[model samples]
Structure formats: structure tokens, C-alpha cells
Target: MRFGSIRVRLTAWYLMMLALGLGVFGVGSWFAMRASVFHAIEEELADRIRDVKTFLQDQTPFRSKIDIRDELSEHSVLGLGGDLFQICDEQGGWLYRSSALESGLVPIRLPSQVGDQPVYENLTVRGAPVRFATARVVIEGHPYTIQVAEPLEEFYEALERFGLMLWISVPLLLIGAGLGGYLISRRALKPVDLITTAAESISINNLADRLEVPKTSDELQRLSETLNRMLSRLDISVQKMSQLTADASHELRAPVSLIRTTAELAVHEARTNTEYHGDMMQILAEAERTSRLIDSLLLLARADAGEGGLQHELTDVSTSIREAMEQGWSLAAGKRIELTANLNSNPIVVRGDGEALRRLSFILIENAIKYTPEGGRVHVRLEGSHAVVTIEVTDSGIGIVESDQPHIFDRFWRADKVRSRSIGGAGLGLSIARWIVDQHHGSIEVQSQPGQGSTFTVKIPLAEIPAPLGQP
Candidate 1:
């Protein structure tokens, strides 16, 4: 019932408009009725004057005023009342005066400009309002002015009754209308209230819970559906964040525990300089691994937050692949693997961040070298198609199972956990490579089979070559 509520405001506006319309209609009707009553009274007076003229014409050639008076008295007996009727000749001599006129209750007044048209006027006679009509008529070369009057008390009473009815009924009608309007508004907004209640019941603990979508194809239904969709997205994001937190905790724990254990062992025992140096190297290696994991996590976080920080420029795909191969040569050599590259005679140019592209190539080559056995072959190839440049890194190594290929790019996910851990692989390299490829608007995919090998292919859009300065 608050005044500021939509329901109350709607009802108030409805009532205001209704009141205005009814007021205008009432005033118009009252004026029209009053005019009609006055017109009817005027017509009655004119008709009476016409009747008198007709009667006087029929009784022509009156020899005396007494004869005219006797005829008028006979006319009165015939239901034409003579109390307010009067007549006069051209010389202002009274021909037939009713008793009401002669008794001075109603005065006799001749029109100054007597004409064929009737002259109507309102008069007060005996302290009562009356309507009079006067007209002149010429009969048998004699002119006569006849006047007729009618009282207005009954007409005024009728108007008062109508006015009273309007005054009393209008407010009652408005009250009923206002009540109806308020009820209708409340019924229409009931759905919104239900939605509000349902929405309030949902929280972080119940993110998976969704609002019921109404079947009424209206704004309320749309609102419910949109809110449900938003809830679904929230649910997905929360689940992903929870998974990331658990995985991050598990990954960081191993390296930190190792570093702590190594330091404690070194401190608790006396050791030679050589032993100390070895312990320090082991500690440094664990520390370095932990730092790498943190950096990968931060990079993925920024990527998820839509901050890729890529400085895009034209980069040579062939050159980046060669650089990554050179970086991976030492590892391949240590493993007795044959590292080689197949590059196009001409450089294949693509649009991307040079450093990110180089890192992408390095991750793929390093992953191949790590998984490949000694005496295995690792190959890098850079090729250009009509619209894109493709980098493919192939290796002859312990390949992935079909089931695990789909999740290889997921953070902290490794197909062979023991092998991955033994080789200092945190499994974040492929995930970071995927992010870098996505930032360059490129696509990366892998084809692998157990006991055969793995091939990682990356495709980036070729950069448009600028024409010479004057060319269009």
C-alpha cells in the first residue's frame, strides 16, 4: 500500500483520468439539459400565443370589448387558461385582460417594436420566475399584441434533482473504479513478486539452482529465462575456479615439500663442499620448477581475465621454428635423438606476437623431445598455404592414448604422470602454448597414437603483404 509502489501509482493515475473525464461529461450533460429545458419552455409559450391568435381570428368583428372578454372566458373554459394571458390593440387599449393581469399579480407590457416574430423574455411575477412571449398579429385590418407566460418552478425542480443525482453518483463511481484499478494492477504484477522471491532464495551455495521459466511468453518469462542463463554461467565459473584451486594446491605442494626436505637434510647433517654443492643444486632445481609453475598459473589467469598482452606484428614462422629447434637440440642430443627441420625455401610470414610464437614453437619441440626415446627422430616443418602458415612438430616417441589427447592442453594434466614428473614436466607447457595460439587467432591440434608418435600442428593466419608505396 506504499504510495510509491507501481500498483498504487497506476491506480492513482487511473482515478485521476477517470475523474477528469467524468467531470467534463457531467458538466457538458448538465449544460445540455438546462438548454433543452429552456428551449421547451420557450416553445410552449410560443404555441400558447399562436393559439390565442387563432382564437381571436375566428371570433372576428367584435362589436365591443365585453364580447372579446366573453369569447376569451369561453376559451378559458375550453382549457386555455387566461390567468396569465393578455391582449392589447394598436392604440394601447386593453382588449382582453385575464383576472391574474387585472389583479396586478402579473403586469401587462406591450413590446416596443411589435413585429411578426415573437419576442420572448423572462419576468418575475408575484415573486416567482416566469417566461413570457409577445407577438403582434394583424387580423381583418386590425393589429393585436398577444402575450403568454409560464412559471419555471417545476422545470427548476427537475434540474435540481438531476444535478443532485450527478453530484452524488460521480464520487461513488470513481471509488468503485479506483478499487478495480488497484486490484487489476496487483494481479498483473504478481508474477514479478514471485520472481523476486525466487531470486532471493538463490545464493552462492545454490548456484546450480535455476528459476522456473513461466510459459506466459511475456517480459516476466524473458526475465526468468535470462536470470536462469546467468545462473548457469555462474555455476560453471565457480566449478572451474574450485577445480583450479585444488589442482594448484596439489601441484605446488610437491616441489615446496621437496625443497623444504632437502634444506632440512642439509642443515641436520655435516657435509663436504661437494655434497653441499649438490644439495644446493637440487634445491635450486626444485625452486626453479616451482617458479615455472607459478608463472604458468599467472599467465593462464591473465589469459582467462582477457589480458593476453600480445604485441602483434608480422613474424617469420620458419625463423621461429628454427630457433625453437636450436633450443631443443641440446636435449635431443643428450637423449641421442636426431633433431631436424623442413623449412620452406622462402620464409612463411604470419601475424602474431614474435616472442609468444617462439615460445609456442619451443613448447611443442621440447614436449616432443621429452616424450621421445633415445635414437628417436624429432622433426619440425614450416609450411605456408594460401591464407595461413602451419607449424608441425612430429616425434617418434611414447605416444598418447586416444582418451588422454583431449585433455592434454588442460592445466596440470599429464597423460603419463610418472613419466611427466620424472622429466620435470608440470604439464602447463601445452596449456600455455594453446593460450598463445588463441591470442594470435590461430588453432592448434594434435594427432597421436600409442607406441607410434605424436604430431602437434599449429596454424596461424598469414599477414597481408603491403604493396609498394604507390600501389592501390
Candidate 2:
């Protein structure tokens, strides 16, 4: 595996863990084995001391005072094989020394008091490991201290072999674990590599293709699913953006072509005043339409960029609605539609941009009048309660169908394309109105059915009423 790769890191971590576990196991085993070996040696030494005590006690009955050196020499064969033995009096002077300890004195200390428990120690004797035990006994009413020691050469040899085996096996185990772990990690991440390649190959033109979903329920599978979801959303957004661009181009081309053609026709010849005035008027009207369309587009763009500049202040929503109604009367009168308002006399105040609220009301009223046939009726109402204010604009117009109602607020979408085209709208009024309401933390709902009529209701929270002067 390459350095710093996941496979290598996994293998390295596995090896580290294995090494730690093996080291703990080896240390524990070594300590356990040493304890068992020493325990066995201790048992043997205790038994030998007991035998020596029994021999000494037997000799005590035969003689009131026995020679320690001679007695130990006669029964020295009864002691531990290839071991050292010594006897000392209470005064700390050696009474007897066996042949094994005669050549070099293996210093042994007796306990201050006699006890049933024997004292044990480990020492080095003649460059070899040894275990020593000291015990106290009473013989013929005389206190005697006995010292017994055994060589540990074979024990040391076994431990050394164990240590050597552990040293040799641990590295091999670590190497095997590393290789196994690398293989497992590589196998697990193989899907990740495939996902990366597939994702890299996908582009805007082929956003419809999705990554393969893995069957196993794991993080990798979830990642694949999440990425596919993101891709789907991006694809939808891109398609919407493309459609918006095409519609914008088509809409802009009309007014621009009209303006150019009208200007060209007016200057192409010395026309009469009436003709010139009509052409100029037509050009001006198209220019105003183009400008309004551009402004609406820019506003939507700003809203999309999260730069919706809304002023937060106390706004009298009823007044704005009345103003929009007054403006709508002219347009309605031109179309011979009945325009009316049912605004509450009490002020319905909200915290939002007054201009934006007026624009929102205008957009809804204009949309109502534009779609309404001649002699149709349009009504605007503003009502307020303790918590929220409601604005409803009802129109007797070509209502939207159930299927098309959901998309009416989408940019550049129209329920009746041919009628909308003849009606001279850029199909952005409802979208802009929706954005305005959203900025004011409000909701707009549409209730419509084909050939019936439409009611657009807007709800915004009511602002706090100011307090009256206090008598206190």
C-alpha cells in the first residue's frame, strides 16, 4: 500500500493494536510462569526443611546435646538434590554448612523470631539464579534456623526459550495482521474508488445518471444515496435555469423588436404629425414594457441572491390595500370590470416594507384585472384579528386548474399560455408577489378552479398596538 493511504493506515493501526495485545499477553504469561515455578521450588524446599527437622528431632532424643556439623553431614543426602543447606544458632553463628555451600558462603539471614511461615528470597549464586528459603525450628529446647537454597539454571533456560519464541512470533503475527488488514480495507474501499470515478465522469449534460446504490447498509451506501439526492436537486435547478433563460430571451426579444421596428418606420419617411405621434407612442409603450420586465427580472435576481432589501417598520397594510384598490379602479374601468375594496376601518399594522406591501397588493390586483373578462367583478378585502392580518383578492376570471395551480407562482409559468401572451404579461407577477410576502414572513394561498374564479389570500402577523397615555 502507498504511504498515507487508508489501506496503509488501517494496516498500521491493526499492527499497533496486535503488538499491544501480544505484549500484554506475553508479560502476563511470563509473570504467571515465574510464579508457578517459584511456588513449586518453595514447596520442595519446605518439605526438605521438614525432613531435616524430623531428623534433628530424632537425634535430640538420643543425646541431650548433639554436634550440629556431624549430624547434618550424616543426613545431608536427605536434603534437596544439588542444593545448598545451612544451620545457624540463635546467636547468628553458623552451626553446620553442607558441602554445596562449603566452597562459597551463600549469605543467608535468619528471621528475628521463629514462625510457622518460611521466608523466601531469590539470589544469584556462582553466576546462576537460585531461590533461598529460611525457617526456624525448636529441637531439644534449642532454637535453630535452617537455610535451604536450590539452583534455577533449568528455570532460567526455559524462560529464555519462551522469551526468544515470543520475540520471534510477535513480529510474524504483526506482519500477518498488517497484510490481512490491508487486504480487508482495500476491499472495503473499492466501492469508494468506483464512486469517485463515476462522480468525476458525470457532468451537467448527463446529470440524469446516478451512482450505483450499494445493497449493504453502511456509511458508504448512505454517502452514495446522499450524493445522488444532491445530483437530482442540481439537475432540477439547472433545468429550471435553462427554461428561465429561454423564456426571458423570448420575452425580451418582442419589446426590443417592436421598439426598433417602430423607430425605424417613424424615421424612414417624413410622416404626418398624427402618424409620428402614434409611432412615438407605440415605441414609448414598448420601451416602458421592456423596462418593467427588466426591473422585475432584476428584482427576482436580487431575491435569489439573498439580497432582498426590505425595510422593517410599522406598515398600515389597510392603507396600502386602499392605494392598490384606487390604482386598480382605472385599469378595471378600462376593461369594464367592477373593482371594489372592503378594507377594515381599524388599522391593520404589520412590520414590513410599506412600498413592498403596496407592490404586492398591486401585483395581485393587476393580475386579477388582467385575467378577468369584460364585465367581471374584482374585490379586495383587508381584515385583522388579534394575532394576524389577512388580505384577500378575489376575481371572477379564468381560474386555474388543479394541476396548474401548484406551478402558478413559479417564474415565467402561465396557466393559459396563449391568453397570457395576448394579455401582455411577462408571467412574473405572482412569483414576485410570493417573494415579497415571503420576505415579510407571510404566507400566500390560492384557491382556484377552472372557469370558476380565484381567491388569493395573504396572511401576515399583526404588529403590537401602541399603548394609550397612562393616568399615573
Candidate 3:
């Protein structure tokens, strides 16, 4: 985070990369250019040697003193940028030198070899670097040393000029690279910068704020879509919490107000034993109802806090349904509702906490029994797919309204508000049941009509089975 803004970091990285690449390119160019300059110099030296050899060969047939001097002076300018040449006798004494030289031929060492042998040397001749080639030969059976040399100052001057030009151009090249890199990074990261600015503008005051993306489908678009999804989830969570807070305040205040007002009424009527006893019964009942509501609220809160850890194992759905029916038999019997099961007694396998599932099954069947009219039927069944077990409970009851069905599993929600609480429920049964199913990675769906009945289906994936016998 201390590395400065995105644009600066991007520009810096681009500049560094471009500088490295260009620096390498410049080094290669410098070396290659220097080699080319040297090659040109070498080619010129070879030409000078060839020209001297030709002149010596032609003058060997008949020696000419003035003619050779004239011919040497004539070609002097064409020789390797004013090359100098001198001829020597067998005794190593200079006979002739190029006219370009101010002084006479100088004494130079000659290699003591019999046949024609070329010797090369670099020396400061006439206050300038020069390459000299010498060859000893016999013309008309007389030994002679033929020497040829060329000035190296022009080549040196060209090299110095190249080095100076490179020195001057390097800074300008780096500056151009830096500028180009900054422009490229800016263009590449413009979309990301736009996304950052847009995100900064969003607020809780405007949860609906969205990224204004162009039609281009790129990584930036994908990033914007992902951020929007997270925002949507946050918005939904906020709405749920707000609604819960309002509903809790409304529900709790009414019961507390009733209790307080009832106690004040009871305080005024303690004159006779009969009046006191009657008032005490009313107070106790209302207090019990309030206590039950608080207990239901606490249970729902525990479930929401994910505290009801499942004691999971493989449990048979048919057996679980039978257990639920037995647990709620008295409640169904009191209402004269016949609780029955359409069960496949086969091993309907499940991998979950048997206790939690049993409790969930009881809650669904209990709801059915409580809501169903007298003599109405509640049926529980165990069904199967290839790799799952399903427990379904259907009942003939005063079914939930379609509008309220969506939120029936929400805590403390009751379709029949006036009737449901009196039936030993603070309306958290479906919520707890749904949470239990979720813990098992199972799902539950409810189908109902206003006057007909309700069907609650629970689906749990099957556990793996060991190798089986043919018909067992």
C-alpha cells in the first residue's frame, strides 16, 4: 500500500521494463557498429597491401628510378587514405619513399626470412596511428624490402565520433522510453482506475449504485460484476436485519405492555379472596404465554447462531417417520386427527443426525395435527430415489395462504396469527425444522392451499453402501 497510487506503480514498472530492453538493444548496436568500422579499416589495409604487391611485380622486370617514383606519387592519394611506401636494398637501406612524406625514407626492421613474407605492425607514424605492411622480395635476383603503411587517424576520429554520439543519444532514448511507457500504462489501467473511482462513490445511502461499464467484455467487466454480486448479498443481509429488529420490537413491546397493565389491574382488585384468586389465574396464564413466546424466540435465536450441532449418522427415514408419529400421537389424538404413515419399511437410508431429523419430522407432523380440523387426516411417508431418501408429510388442514407461504420458515411467522400461538407454538417450528435440514445438506419444500391441505417434503442424500448380497 505504501508503493503509491496504481498509476504511479504501473508507470514505474512499465518504465523499468522498457529501459531494460532498450539498454540491451543499445549495447548490441554499439558493439556491432564498432565492429563494422573496424571491418572497413581492415578492408582498406588489404587493398593497400595488394596495390603495393602489384607495383613491385611490375617494376621487377626493368627497374625505373624516376618512373617508379612518379607512379608511386600518382597513386599515393588512392592508397589507404594517403598510405606511405618505401623500397629498400638487400642491405636494409631506403631507396624511395612516398612523395606525401616530408622527410626521406626511414630505417625500418625487416624480418629475416628467405621467401616473400609479409610483416604487419602498428606504430605512430608522422604523429598519427598507422598500420604498416612490409614484404622482402628479389627483383632481377637483387633483394629488396617493400614497405606500405596507411594513416589510422580518420578511423580513430570516426570511432570517437560514434562514442560521443552514443553518449548524447542514450539520455534522449531513455527519456523517450519513459514517456512512451507512461502513456501505455495509463491507457492499459484506465478501466481499473474508473472502477476504483466508481466504487469510492458508492455508499450505504445508495446500495443500488452499480458500475457503469462499457460494452467491452473484459476482465474489468468481470471484476465489476463480482463486486456487484457481493454488494447485493450485503444489501439483502441489511434488509433482513432491519426487518428482524422492527418485528422483534413490535412483538416484545405488546406482551410486556399487557403484563404491566394486567398487574396494575390486579393490584386494584385484591379486596376479597375470590376476586384475588380470579385475578391471579388470569395473570399466571398471560405470564405463561409470555414466557413461552420468549422461550420460542430464544430457541430460534440459538438455531440462527448455528448452535444446534447435529449428532449425525446413518438413520432410516421409515423408522424416523414412525418415531415422529409416536412422539406426536397424543397431540393428534386430542384433536381427533388420525395420524397415519404410508411407509416403505425398506431401509430408507440417510446420513445425518438421527435425533435432529427425528425432531424435525415431529415438528412438521405436529404442525399438521394442530392445524387440521377434527377427524382430518395427517399422513407421513418414506419415499426413495436412486441415491436419496425423502420424508414427506401431508395433511388436511387450514393451510397457509399463498402470500404467506414464502416466509413460513422465518422465525415467529404465523399464517393464522390469532390461532397458532394458542396451539402451544410461538411459530418457530418451521424455522428450526428448515435449519436442521440445511445442516444435513438436505432441502425442504412446502406446498399448500387455503382450504385444502399442506405437504412438506424433506430430501436427504443417500450414504454410500458397502458391497451387497443378491437379495438381502
Candidate 4:
């Protein structure tokens, strides 16, 4: 048996407790037996003393030593074997001693002071143990002492036998009990063994596999359920990571291939200054696009790793919205789209990273401008209430279908793939926007209908305290 295993440890503990209990019981039983046996011996000796007193009182007149000896000799024969009795007068003269006492095999002593109560003693006579009781009696106005003794060999022998039985049976009982306990522990942990086996068999490729959950309604069942849930989370994360990798590869390929092709064409052919300049401009544009895609991917990677390091300083939501609209103004004007904002007179302060808030506003506004048709209107609104500040960006653009709304924010997902590519939108803008909102403990949602328009709303909790003066 492996001592480190729970089964062995459980069994060991059970046997240890059982052994302690049995030991206590054995010692208690031994003491109880000893007390009972000695009590019975003392009672017998007491009864013998009383019989001697009665015999002396019944023979009232004679009171001669001869009569007392004759009467006691006959009475002593009525006792069990190895019983002895001796009597003495108050003056220390021996009246009678039993043959067993006279034979010198048992030396019974008279107590120095005899009283109304009896005195009991244990003695070793001729290498055998004995119990003696002495008492004083007044017979016919004369004081006398009577002593009685009983051999303790039988009582000692009985105790020795009981002790031997305990010594022998206790070990045997413990052995059997330990075996049973080990078996019980093994059976109880069988489910744990199965769980271990199932878990070991699973790998990254089989993350969808789950452990068999037992219906025991115990810790084992709960453990299996928790492990299954963890596996499910891992499966989902892995699948998303795989999808992200594929999408990033696809998105990055276009810009990288264009730059490579442009460079090759410039190098292999002799061209005029104008052609060379045009080729260089095309390469730079592709490089810039690739750089932007890489930066976005890195930002998302940092976000997923919980290292985005967003600041928690008080920021003015209205100021960030105005900045975002100012940046998008040129693009909207170039497209002949009316870009406008409706901001409250007072600053809407919230606790968040100022730079990140500005970036979040820009991503939404830019996304709206990119998707909205030329001559369409894009409006930005910032409003604040007691608890939360809301930012709504409404665009009169090509709206999204209901079924595609849920996945619009997904990384690298685009409602109009061809339009997104033409507009240089790598589909990471909304994802990053969502992460920023989440960092500020806020929510963002979009309401859109096909052929109508789209409204993107962001709600962020207001700062607990007003921003200090000149601390935008």
C-alpha cells in the first residue's frame, strides 16, 4: 500500500482510533474485574468472621478454651478449601488456630489493634497470595479477636487468563478491522480514480471532452462539474483564438502583398521619375495600413492579457467627443457628409483614461463615417445624468441586418466585407471600442435597421466627485 495515498491514510487513522478505543476498554475491564473479585473475597472473609463470633456467643456458659477450640474446629471444616481462621483472647493468648494455619503453609497475622470494624490485608504466604480480615468481638463480657484468610491463587489465575485473552484478541480484531477499513476507503474513492483517468486522457485537441460526472451528490460530483465547466471555457477561448489568428492572417496578407508587389515592380523595371514616385507612394500607403493593423492586433493582445494599463483619472467625456468629431470633420467633409455634435454646456466627467476615452470616441465616429454614404449625415451627442454619461453616435448610413448585429463587434468581423476592405477598415475598431468601454465599467450597444440608419450608444458611470478646476 502506498502510504501517501488517501486510502491508506484513511485506513491508518481508522485503525489508530479503533486501537485506542479498544485499549481503553481493555484497561477499564481489567480494573473493573479486579475490583469485583477483591470485593467478593473481602465479603467472604467478613462472613467467616461473623460466623466465628456467632459460634462463640451461642456457647454461652462454658467459655473454656477447650470448648471454643472444639467448636471452631468443627465450624472451620464447613469453609471452602484453603480457608483459615485463628482466634485470640484480649490478653494475647491463642484460643484456636485452624490446621491450615498450624501447618505453617499460611502465616496469618493478628492485627495489633482490633476495633469494632474489620481490618482487611493482603499477604503472601508460602509463595501464594492470600487475603486476611481481622475483627474484634465481645463474648460473655470478654474481648476476643478473630482473623480469617482466603487463598487468592484462583482469583489471580482468572485475571491472568482474562488479560491473556485480551492481548490475543485485540490484535486479531484490529487486523480484521484495518482490512475492512482499507477496503471501504478504496471503494469510496473509486470515483476520484475514474476522474483522474478521464482527465489524463484529455488533451488540447480534445478540450471539448468532459469528465464523467457521477450522480453521487457529493464532492466528487461537484469536482467533476467544476472541471467540466473549466474545460468548456478553455474550448471556447481556444476556438476564438484560432478564429482570430486566421482572420488576422487574411487581413494582413493584402497590405503586405501589395507592398511587396509594388516594391518588386519598382526594382525590376526602369521607370520615369513620376512612375517611381507613384510606386513609392503606393508602397508607403500599404506599409501604413499594415502598421495600423499590427498596432490594433497588439492592442487587443494586451487587452486579452489584462495588461492594457488604462488610467483611472477624471476625464471630460464631452471634450473627448468634441475632439473625435473634430478629427473626423475633414473626412466627413471630403465625402460631402454633414458631421455634427450636440454636447451639453457642462463637462460630463468620468473616471477613466483620457487618452483611451478619446480613442474610443474616435473609433466609433470614424467607423460611422467610413460606412455612411457620401452626402449622409453623422451626428455625435454627449449627455450626462446623475449617475451615468451617455454618448450616442447616429449615422445615416447603410444599416446592419438584425442577424448580423450580434457579431458586428467581433474581432475582424465586417457586415460589408468588400466595403470594409475598400475603406481600409480591418474590422478591429469596434472590438477595441468595446474593450475600452469595458475597462471603464460601462456598456455599449448599437441599434440599427437595414436601409435605415445606426445609433451607437455608450453609457459610463459618472465620477463620484466633480473634477477639480483646470483638471480636464
Better of 1 and 4 by TM-score: 4
lDDT of 4 by residue, 1-472 (tens): 7899999999999999999999999999999999999999898888878877887888847667798677777767876222477877777777888876776554433434778688888888778888888888888888888888888999999999999999999999999999999999999899999999999999999999999999999999999999999999999988988898899999999999999988999999999999999999989988889999999999998998789989999888888888888899899999999998899979889999888998999998898888888999999998899699999999998888999999988999898888788889999999999999999999999999777789999999999995789999
| lDDT, candidate 1, 206-232, per-residue tens | 998888787889998999999999999
Query: How many clashes does the backbone of model 3 have?
Result: 1
Which digits, one per residue and each the tens of the lDDT, describe model 2 over residues 1-472?
Answer: 4886777887888888889999999888988988899899999999888887887778767653347467677667654322488877777677778887877558656535656567888888778878888898888777888888888899989988988888899889888888888888999988888899999999999999999988779999999999999999989988877887788899999989999998998889889999999998988888888899999998987887789888999989988888888888899999999998888998878999888999999999999999888999999988898689999999999888889888989998887778786677888999999999999888999998767789999999988767778933
What are the models' TM-scores? 0.77, 0.87, 0.81, 0.91
Once fitted onto the true fold, the runs of candidate 4 whose alpha carbons sit more than 4 angstroms away are 61-63, 80-82, 104-112, 466-472
Between the candidate structures 2 and 3, which one is better when assessed by lDDT? 2
Q: Which clashing pairs does model 2 show?
A: none
- Candidate 3 CA-lDDT value: 0.75
Better of 1 and 3 by TM-score: 3
Q: Alpha-carbon error at 408 in model 2, in Å?
A: 2.5
* Model 2 spans with C-alpha error above 4 angstroms: 2-4, 63-82, 89-97, 107-117, 311-314, 401-403, 449-452, 463-472
Error of 1 at 252 (Å): 0.6
lDDT of 3 at 276: 70
In terms of TM-score, how similar is model 2 to the real structure? 0.87
lDDT per residue, candidate 3, 183-286, as tens digits?
A: 77677777888888999998886777787774458777788888888888877766766776677676667667876877788786555777778767767777
Q: What is the lDDT of residue 411 in candidate 3?
A: 70
